[model samples]
Target: MEGRIAAKAEQDGAVAAPRRAPSQQRSRERVERMLAAASALIAEQGSDAMRMGEVAERAGVSIGSLYQFFPDKRAIVWALAERRTAEGQACIAAALKDVGDAEGLRQAFSGLVDIYYGLFLAEPVMRDIWSGTQADKALRELELADSRANAEFLVAALKRLRPKADPAELEATALLVWQMGEAAMRLAISVDREEGDRLVAAYKRMALRELGDG
Candidate 1:
């Protein structure tokens, strides 16, 4: 994954802090359960409609326990966002690990898109977090910043694929690709299943062409 991307996000203050850090395995597990319950609520309703007490109840923890990890809905959302972003980065890293040619890159990109699409479809919380981020100014800014970090990761991968390419151009293209993928994802979810598959395929073609491939 893009190890530095998350670090850069933290450095830039895009991440929100939890009420307390999970220090022990048990604490971490408790916090995970709380977040999981919160995710279910956010997925069922919206983040604004999610209640802390209900989250604790669903998690089988006390209300105080929920507050021990997350202070508010915003903190829960941020943690979820961070988790999702990390998963996406891991997908990209795994997909590109064995890529050696344009065809390989295309396959890897396709895999990356498929993984993200599945994630969003399977987890309503992911969709909610993405939509929420776009609607909030501060979150929108953070999303854009994270996009850039993801782009830089892609730039590094592209350099491996095409070492002769111009550095500046590669950087620009990577950012464009990353943003395009995001847009495609938004559209994909809003449309029917078959159409969404076609849309994703089209995006793969465009991404490959922009990367100086098919």
Candidate 2:
């Protein structure tokens, strides 16, 4: 439910900044094509094996045009990750809108898990992208920042679900929920599809139990 998007800031030996963002409609469309091409390549081959030239060729844009939006492969991956994160957040926010109690939270969590499972299944390259963030310290910081944003969103949802709960405890609980949910999702995707569904169901029950849901 977290670990997406980045500020493209200088941190811990990572790139000092992101490439210039597309300013005009045509440039934006080209950037979209480049990112789309990169994603397709990453899905077909691991990110490490993908090349900028290949992406540009697949996108039908000049290599120079691709570089105009993403200076390197990492930038391409980062932008893709950012797009995925934004999508994940939107899904969670929409799910939360209908959640009103522990039972609602349980159902919403099940849906959330399903969404993530589908996301990973559909875009296998995201698994590698996530792993890369762990090996790179600066990307890990970006991930933490992304997680914090998601944590705040979780906290807001929890407040709506259990308004009588202590604010401090809710904050801590929200963080735990996010971490545990993320771990569960990773595990779920690592197993067979049917087994993954079972795992997600079990996690939903366990997580709801932790929140005092009967």
Candidate 3:
């Protein structure tokens, strides 16, 4: 559950950062190719079985070049996961903004659930990457940081909805909602599609009702 949004301290050795940051356009393009290759391999098989050399070969880059940007397979997975998280953050911002009433808030909550669930269903690689986070403490920490970031977006919206509510209380509520929502999504993906949709719908209804009460 915690690994869905997983930890954020990138400096930890467990996940392994890129050997060097790509600054130039050519370097960035190469990094993107490496990521795309790794993502495809992870989707085709699993991160546990994806080999660095294969990724490099698929990307049409040398193995040395792959290692230059990603020290190991975990780093590649982390990059892909982090990129997806960024996309989620943007979606969260868009879905939760401009809400000033109960109806609007409910719609926003629904949007959040639908958008995230859609992503999980559409992108199989995310499931594998998130699962890996549970075993890697560094990746888990990365998720925690990401969870907090997502929670902050929720808090911002909550602050608007509950002007008189204590800030600390709202922050706590935001984190709780986010983590549980992530857990729900994780669980939803683990089951059949029909059951998964039902689970997502149930969570959305429960969340909307609870937040509506606030």
Candidate 4:
């Protein structure tokens, strides 16, 4: 009887294990659908127009399923913001790779700014989310952390550029650079493409000069 019971338990475990894969896959697919729907809705009507029902309908899922994946619209927006932030961080990392010393730092800084500017320009929704009502306190905190990470990246590049600079001064300079770049990108979005390009170029030059590289 003990052996039979053990055999039955093993059989139940095997049955449960097979079910787990499809269950997890279904969950992931549902979440992906929700995210895709949210992105489309936000792009078409802005965040204000995004309703959970609309997301569910667009994703071809029921409202209950939508809630299962995301608690509310804010949760959806937060997930989107996190995705965009990760993409930006990856781009910055790629741009800085193989970069050496201060002069390399200057080039890396300019490249990083250009990549980020292009990213935001390509995805205006991201800018709208950042500057619009979609931004809540939680999202704002996330943005602050993201900004700090970018600043730290700049600091690392700067240290390579100016190995002799004081640590505190290097950190301060990195923070300034990060802020300046962010402001430049925000301003660029309002102007004509040519003007925006010029603005970014000017900002890059100013940043380089500030770092004493120009």
Q: lDDT scores for all predictions?
A: 0.78, 0.74, 0.81, 0.71
103 in model 4: Cα distance from truth in Å? Answer: 3.4
lDDT of 4 by residue, 1-214 (tens): 2223223433544211111112587788878888899998988888877898999999999998777657678767766776777777777767776667666877777778887888778875787677653235555555655677777777776677677889788787767877667778878887899999999999999888887652
For model 1, give the RMSD to the true fold: 2.9
Model 1, span 124-199: residue lDDT tens: 8888888766765545655676678778777777888889888999998988898888888888988998999899
Q: For residues 130-171, could you state the per-residue lDDT of candidate 2 as single tens digits?
A: 757667665566666656666677778788877788888877
TM-scores, each model vs. reference: 0.86, 0.87, 0.92, 0.81
Model 2 residue-pair collision total: 0
For residue 194, model 1's alpha carbon misses the true position, in angstroms, by 2.9
Supply candidate 4's per-residue lDDT for 134. Answer: 24
Q: Which candidate model has the greater lDDT, 1 or 4?
A: 1
Query: Of the candidates shown, which would achieve the greatest TM-score relative to the real structure?
Result: 3
Candidate 1, residue 211: Cα displacement in angstroms equals 1.0
Q: Candidate 3's error at 83, in angstroms? A: 0.7
Clashing pairs in 4: 102-161
Instruction: List model 3 lDDT by residue over 33-58, tens digit each.
Output: 99988889988999889999999999
Runs off by more than 4 Å, candidate 3: 1-10
